[model samples]
Target: MKTRTWAPYALIAPTLVLMAVFLVYPIASVGWFSLRHHTVTQPWKNGFIGFENFRRMLFEDQLFWQSLVFSAKWVVVEVGLQLVLGLVLALIVNETFVGRGLARSLVFSPWAVSGVLTTGIWILLYNPSTGIFQQLAQWGIGDAGTSVLGNPETVFPATVVTELWRGVPFFAILLLADLQSIPKDLYEAASVDGAGRWRTFVSITLPHLRDAIVLSTLLRAVWEFNNVDLIYTLTGGGPANQTTTLPLYVARKAVDSHDFGYGSALTMAGFVILLFFSILYLRLSKFGSRA
Candidate 1:
């Protein structure tokens, strides 16, 4: 027993050490920095200023609140659409058909692409002069010089669609894997009972997929909350900060304003919000209850 216990620890020692160095240490450092008045531009003012950064963020920053609201909206809209579309895609691809292998690969290909590349592709598509809109205009479908990204009225929806193109595939792939793991016997039994497709799905398929759907939604929510690359590259929170998210706000704080202390405080606030939401979501959803 002693040897076994020691061997397990020895095997895991490197992983634990790496986690400490990479994850725990950075988190601890950020916490420490949050209580200070550190700024790259104003080095002379760098020092401890307990709770001041938090105070400013809470009471004085309008942009912080705006970004927080936008972040909530962004996560909700993006995750909801992605979940619906992805579930449909997963179900369709799960069905046995000719060319299914190639279809699955093609449908899932977007999830493998990097966010930067996705943003670049979207930028080209959304461009005013030579984009899809222009091509369509040549065929007399719509007006040319339609700037979707530049117009505030269309920017939010445009950004959501761009993200959905990549985000849906992630959900589809994950849910599809879980869908495949479901025992074929259950469906056979349902069919024998003369259960309709909708009834079988509601009774068997949904219950089986409950845990996966809950977990994936949570993870995708967090990811969308933190996602800055596509938005930054595509919109840069343009058209009067309509697309600005909390993470993008933090990036601007740290990068543009050189306010490390304020940025750290914002980061901590985001972490707390995410933790509270995750816990609340799991509790309300009754996750793992079926298992």
Candidate 2:
């Protein structure tokens, strides 16, 4: 019995060691850095400073609050839309139809694309002079130079749509996997009971998908909140910092300003916010609870 227990731990020892070295160590380093006055630009000022970074972030930085608010909005909007759209796509693809295999492959292709590539693709598509909009304008649809990314009014929506294009595929793939695992017997039973499609879906399909939906949404929310690549590459949080997220702000702090300590503080703040939101969301949704 002891050998059996020890064997499992021995097998997993390398994995645990790697996690401690890579994940735990980085997180601990960031936490420690957050308490210090460390900036690459000003090496002389690099020293221990307790809670000073947090105080400045909380009380002095308006951009921090702005980025936090945008991060919240970005997560909520992106995750919600991705969930709804992905569920719809999954349901559609789950149904028997011609070219279903091809359709699934095509739809899921976007998820395989890297964030930087997606950003690049969308940048070309959104370019005012040579993009789809310009082509449409040539067809006498609208103005010839409608700068979506440049305009503050349209930038947010445009960015959201661009992200949705790439993000929806991920949710669809996950939800579709879960959908496939659902037994057909439930549907047949519901059909025999004269349950309409809507009723059957409500009573059977949704209940079965509850855990998957909750978990997927939670993960997607966290990803969207921390998502910097697409937004950074596409918008660079430009047009007056309208699309700046917390992660993007941290990136700027670290890269642009060389404020590693303050960046670490921001990173810690993000961790806390995500942790709180995840706990609250899971609790409220009663995730993993029996129906």
Candidate 3:
């Protein structure tokens, strides 16, 4: 009995050790640093003041709240769009048709694209002079203004669209899996009762997909909240603070300003907010133990 229990631990020991070194240790260090004030002006000489960094960030920094709000809105739109578009694609792919396998591969091909590549491609498309949109703008149909990502009016929504291009593919694939997992017999039974496609989807398909949908939504929300790469590469959160989300703000504080402690405090705050969103998703999902 002891050997059996120990065997499982032995197999996962490396993974646990890696998590401790890479994940847990860094998180704990960030917590420790966030409580102190470390500035480049003082360099090595530093003094600790508990909660001061957090207090300053929470109350005094207006950008913090703005970033939080912008990021919240971004997630709301991104997750919603992902769900709608992904579900549509999954439903289409689930149909019994020839060449569906190839069709699915084509649809999900974008998921293999790197985040950096996606941002870069979108930036090119947003370029004023030679971009696809710019050409369309000349014809009076598309946005012909300055850099789409650089426009205060357009930046947030524009970036969200770019993000969607990458995100929807993954969402579609996951939803497709969930859609395939649903048994065909359920639909047959529903049809026998004179139920239509919409009724069967509502009664049978959606119930089976609830768990996958919850998992995908929560994962996407968390990752999107932490997304610095896409925003940083796309517009650098300009033409003003319009596109600046929490991650970008934290990056500016840490890397650009070289205020480690303040940035760490910002990171802590972000972690707390994301954690709350996660807990709320869990509560809403009715996720019980996998019995």
A best-first ranking of the candidates according to their lDDT comes to 1, 2, 3
State the local distance difference test value for candidate 3: 0.85
TM-score of 3: 0.90
Model 2: CA > 4 A from native:
1-6, 277-291
Q: Give all candidate RMSDs, comma-separated.
A: 2.5, 2.6, 2.4
In the range 72-184, model 1's lDDT, one tens digit per residue, is 99999999999999999999999999999999999999998887999999989889888998999889997876699988899999999999999999999999999999999
lDDT, candidate 2, residue 38?
95
C-alpha lDDT of all candidate models, in order: 0.93, 0.91, 0.85
Cα error of candidate 1 at position 120, Å: 0.5
Give the 10-residue window scoring lowest on summed lDDT in candidate 2: 1-10
Q: Which parts of model 1 have CA positions greater than 4 angstroms off?
A: 1-5, 278-291
46-125 per-residue lDDT for model 2 (tens digits): 99999999999999999999998898899999999999999999999999999999999999899988789999999899
What's the CA RMSD of model 2 in angstroms? 2.6
Q: For model 3, how does the per-residue alpha-carbon lDDT over 1-291 read when each residue is reduced to its tens digit?
A: 446467898899999999999999999999999988887867875669899988998789998999989899988999999888998888899898999999988988878887789888877887878998878877899567677666677777788788888889878889888888888888888999999888888999889988888888988888888888888778777777777899999898877888889999999988888889888877776666544
